[model samples]
Target: MAAPIYKVAIVGRANVGKSTLFNRLISEKKAIISDIAGTTRDRNYAVCHWRDLEFYLIDTGGMGEKSKDIINQQVSTQAIQAMAEADLILFVVDVRVGATTEDRILAKSVNRHKTPKILVINKVDNNRWRQNNDDFYRLGLENQALVSAANGVGTGDLLDQVVTALKKIKKKKSKKNGEENIRTIKVSVVGRPNVGKSSLINTILGEPRLIVSDQPHTTRDSQEIIITHNKNKIILVDTAGIRRCSKKSGDDFEKMAVEQSLENVWRSDITILVTDVSEPLTWQDKHIIDEVIQQHNGLIILANKWDLVKNKDTKEYTNYYREFFGFARWAPIVFTSTVKKLKIGELLDLLVLIYQEKHRVITDNALSKLLADTIRRHKPTKGAGTKHPYIYNLKQTRTNPPEFMIKINFKAILHESYLKFIENNMRYKFGFIGVPIKIRVAKSQNLQDK
Candidate 1:
């Protein structure tokens, strides 16, 4: 049996290099690093291994003076939650800015958690800056490490301290049999600004892991969290809200964020595209759908904010969306209200179902039978030439965006409509309800000879 991964949270005030420190510790650019304060509104998580010890590293939004704004309050709440769950806390402070009243107040809050903490004085790039590190000692934390996260200086000493601290804490044994083999599905929740994507993820997690606000673009970085539900491991990714490229061109930060959001869809196994029920489907939504389909990624459409809709007839809305988004007919649609917590559990169930279907494979014999029956029912029309395209063999080449290869007669050009017909037949015969399938054609050796 393996031991549980100890959790270490990097927490501090906004713009104090928390995200930079997180990226440094994980040795990856998983979190977005920006000079703007409050750039990271959600708690981003990753696993870090130091000196043979594996631990979970969490990067939380800055915590400081409380504000009445819902987003600020939510961010503070999430930081506190991370502090409570962590076995140790990395209290980060900026050396150049020095410690302020907010740092003192935040220090007091960290002390209340009763968790062991190490003060990390960041941005101390050279010996001159190292002298100023003593100024942060006024915060009253005993242990301290100096480092410049941006340039990766003095991080080794910081990690050594972390490892030494972890050695004292006892860890529980993990079940060895089949536990390490559990498959984790990466589900990326994406949509336009203010579409309740973060709210929906918080509802499923049953915690305010992300900051929710009425303002658009509240979340700027892609946050990844792992949760176990019904013995299934799921990696839920909450990405930055995507805005139109034209609207984002003026701001380089926003442009980068939008690009990162699109990249998340490409990297994920499945994408949950959230849309507002009150608003009509727009060109941006269609553009995102096209990207998902073009990437050959599995997709699920979620009509969020359903409670705001006055119409109780969901069937009518469903029919309208079906017609409006006919291009994504393979994607299943679900109505949800993140505020009301309606069908949130059902959403997770559907996520698991679709993930399973995405990796489903069809037997060669079954695929052959299905192809024969489909051709007999509706024969394909002739293409540019006089001879019609005759499929000689069909076999599934791979799964996860299931790809199939078909050997056909030479010079038999299959029309786009004919390919769609074949795909429809494949979907109807095999239950690939919420996944995209790719079909390829090749000329048979015998047909090539002719």
Candidate 2:
């Protein structure tokens, strides 16, 4: 049967980056950009054919955007309208700030909608960094797809997961097949109430464009400003601080702000998980990290307020995840003090490096030779005390996490420790400096039969 066209709406609290993702999805239809109704129906928003799914993209602003201080009311109305018409709603949340009463309110409201929804934990570039978000699970979303819309970082996986979710709910969609031209890094600074996330963002921007005050939850709604550094233009998202539930109405904007922050993460390639150096990594920090990993985005840990720490060990912060998430062995780490703005330039430089690492690749001969040598030296140990055979003749097929297809004996599992050794060997022979390596294993065909 021919597939029915499905509507996909990017909606969340105001400034949660629905517009940015919308522009990214329908960038080719520049002529149709409007404030009110480019995609209330199936005809608008040019689409991309992903796997077997066809999707029509729509965008909606937070409810009651008209009353907001900064955001345009008309645009907000469009966003709200788009969400109601969408088959699936991408609920974005900020991990650093944790969950707010506003989020619960939105969750309550969204739950009543009967629409298949996927909560996207955005601004999660680092899995090690989390501040708050687990409280959001009560929203009734069992599985959430994580993605960084900025670098296209787990976006493919997020899309795949979202589609899977959509299939289960039977909220089918069909989008017009076309090329999408969305490029630029959209970064949203979000964290626990008064965690200095805004101060850190303002510090990096070197501007007071985003308001900062001693007051908690000062900034409401998501505000974006674009700046160019190192020849790269990036969109900076300033969000209201997320806090525990307060007055019903007050919580609404703040929780919505958190949602917007999450959307910003989903729309961004990388996220700077801003945290106070002195404070312990709380549930909020952990929640933020969980969301970032969920989205597959790259993360850089920024220990803000470093000036407050007296003679602390830098190595601990640098190697925080060496024992935790083994996969983050190569994730870049940096320390910064918003008060002193120390190492700010170096941090940004590291960002460019982190962005570049995903694209690094080594030649095939070197990979194969290294793979063969590593396997021969430390043979794989299978379960039940069997030492499996080796992998030989590896060839580089792609870049970005540096994938390599290797011929190996399928009898054994590739041990993480052994994998690290091979990676070290590769880095030594051919400098991978900032990039992470991805190794693929394949079985050798029958020799005698051939």
Across 349-437, the per-residue lDDT of candidate 2 in tens digits comes to 76666566556666766666776676677765443336464555667777644566656555545566665677777767775544446
Poorest lDDT segment (10 consecutive residues) of candidate 1: 441-450
**Model 2 score (lDDT):** 0.60
Steric clash pairs (candidate 1): none
Q: How close is candidate 1 to the true structure, as a TM-score?
A: 0.94
Tens digit of lDDT per residue, candidate 1, span 40-121?
Answer: 7778888888887888898998897879878888888888888989999999999999998899999988888777899999
Instruction: Provide TM-scores for the models.
Output: 0.94, 0.53
> What is the number of backbone collisions in each predicted candidate, taken in the order shown?
0, 35
Q: Which runs of model 2 end up more than 4 angstroms from their true locations?
A: 1-190, 239-255, 316-327, 383-387, 423-438, 444-450
